[model samples]
Target: MHVDLTRDSVAMGDDVDAPHRQSLHLTDDASLGDAVSAVLARPYLAQIGGGKATWLVVVDGTVSAVVAQQWAGPRWLADARVRAPGAIHFRYLAQRDPGEVYVEYSRCQGQP
Candidate 1:
């Protein structure tokens, strides 16, 4: 599966003061697990001081899942909820108080 990351798309939440949205482009062949790991590995997400980051995952120009990562304490956490072609979400939590959180996802080459 191949995932593309871009800052081009924006989705506004109910709050008028909410930040602009970002999105992740996923190929039809992309797996949610792989895509989530790629986003979590971004260096910008490793910054200190807790904040929320979200990305709308789109497949073939259609929104498929919403991935979010947040940190506020000793752990950095992320999750993805798929809304197309399936219904599922995965949770990732790592201790981040004294070290970095490493994200790695592995799957069979022919599997999705």
Candidate 2:
């Protein structure tokens, strides 16, 4: 299943077919943390996208390397908080890498 979270809502899906995917509309009014928790409520496999995230290892990508990297986690979310009314994007990685995950949030440009 795929899970997504925004500043105000959470969505989930179980398949590649967009029309047949599933989601849980948690709320329209929420904090970033709340949205994340709501997303965690669902079940999934892994991640691919990292927004100011840290990973010990990455594979199959062009930049496949064993390296340690970290970013301003809270500050990025803080930026998102300031840019409210944003959208959450969630997707599944390849079936071979079910242990991967991808989660991201971004406010529409010029929407202050």
Candidate 3:
């Protein structure tokens, strides 16, 4: 995914105020909810791709999910975002027949 470091944020702990929180733009199909659980468990991404950056999935101005995915290899440089590895969860939010995926990340960890 084309990560916009200028538009990303991060909250270390369970503090009401996030230590670092900024608006990020992710072009990949991954969402935010996909990364929440993984991030909570481990701050860093194991592989790469979607999990590389912590994201918030927003659809129509509402938080639909959290996403995190593994990173891709160098061969995937052509379109890194499309090959991200991670999980997407929108259980709390209502599912749309055909919804959009928005991933907001702190940084863009390019493919190896």
Clashes of each: 0, 8, 28
RMSD of 2: 12.0
Per-residue C-alpha lDDT of model 3 across residues 29-77, encoded as one tens digit per residue: 6533322332334433223233344333433233433443321211111
Best by lDDT: 1
> Whole-model Cα lDDT per candidate?
0.36, 0.28, 0.29
What's the true lDDT of residue 31 in model 3? 38
Lowest summed lDDT window (length 10), candidate 3: 71-80
Q: What is the TM-score of each candidate against the true structure?
A: 0.33, 0.30, 0.20
Model 1: per-residue lDDT, tens digit, 1-112?
Answer: 2333433212233225232233555666555555655565654233223444443334444433334455322122222333222322222232322222222111121112
The local distance difference test score of model 3 is 0.29
Error of 3 at 112 (Å): 32
lDDT tens readout by residue for model 2, 7-90? 211125323334323344545555444443454455422333452222211111211111111322222313223211233433
Clashing pairs for model 1 are: none
| Cα distance off (Å), candidate 3, residue 100 | 23
